[model samples]
Structures are given as structure tokens and as C-alpha cells.
Target: MLKKEAHYQEHHFLSSDYSKLMKDPQIDDAWQSDIDSLSPYLERLTMREQRWLIGHAIHDQPPHNIAAKYGVSTETVKGWRKNAIKKLRNM
Candidate 1:
């Protein structure tokens, strides 16, 4: 189980650039549509994972910053983001 989880996290992560689209300050109809689509998937993740995802992905926060907020290491924050994406893909 541990090995599989590690493999999944390592292999399924997307570039931070993918989340940059949502980092824009503009709020438009298309942005609403995107959020609507993303909501269900994001809701399925653990609270910690969701927080990490939103911070790192949607908000374009650095991993270290997220880690500091969560009282975890930067790598742990990255793991949360990657695992959250893996769960989204598997769903």
C-alpha cells in the first residue's frame, strides 16, 4: 500500500503551470464554469489535500508557503498536492 501510494504520487502529478490558469484575478463567466467543474472533484479530496491543492494550484502559492501554513515540510505539501491530483484522476 505504501509503495503504491508513493508510485501514484510520483507518477500522477501535473505541472504547477496547469493550475496557473485559475490564479488570474479576473472573474469571468468561463472562470465560474471552470470552478463549477472543479468543485466536485476538489470536494472528494481530504481537507488537507484540498487546502494544499487550492493553495498551491488555484492560488499559485509556493510549496514552502503552504507547508509553513500547515506546519509540515515542503515535500509533504508537494505530496499532498500530487496525491490529491491522483485521487481526482482515479475518480
Candidate 2:
């Protein structure tokens, strides 16, 4: 598991960027639609899982760094990111 402080920092970083990106009307609409379409799959994820996916996607973080932050192996983070991409493609 990630340490509490690490998790808090990650969330803070992601939330700030998310807020800025969502202010763009074009990006915001597309993002909201994508989220709505993927709602079922997203709902199945835990809060931490959702945060990880969002953070990775929005920030374009490398798998290794994401794995370190999330306390998972790089392979595991890669798998989750791949799965998220697949889900988004289907949506």
C-alpha cells in the first residue's frame, strides 16, 4: 500500500490538474461523456483504483513512477493502464 502522505500528495496533484483541464469546454464535454459511457466499469473500481487511473491518464505518468507511487509492481500498473485504455476504447 502507498503511505498516507504519498497518497495524499498524488491526489492533490491529480485533482489540481483535473480541475484545470475540466475548465476547457471541449475537453470537459468529451471527458464527461467518456466518463458517463464508462460509468459501469469505473464504478466497479475502488476509489484508489479510480484515482490511479485518472492520475496516470491525465498526467501521462510513466508506468514505473505510477507503480512506485501506488506501491504496485510496474507490470501491475501497466496492466491496469492497459485495461483502462481498453475500457475507454470500448466506450
State how far residue 40 of model 2 sits from its true place (Å). Answer: 9.6
User: Against the hidden reference, what TM-scores do the models get?
Assistant: 0.56, 0.44
lDDT of 2 by residue, 19-59 (tens): 45445453455467655554455554434455456556655
lDDT of 2 at 22: 41
For model 1, where is the 10-residue window of minimal lDDT? 13-22
**What RMSD, rounded to one decimal, does every model reach?**
10.0, 8.3
Q: How many residue pairs clash per model?
A: 0, 0
Clashing pairs for model 2 are: none
Q: Give candidate 2 regions above 4 Å deviation.
A: 1-49
How well does candidate 2 match the true structure in TM-score terms? 0.44
Kindly give the stretch of ten consecutive residues in candidate 2 with the minimal lDDT sum. 10-19
Residue 34: error of model 2 in Å? Answer: 13
Q: What residue pairs are clashing in model 1?
A: none
Global lDDT of each candidate: 0.68, 0.59
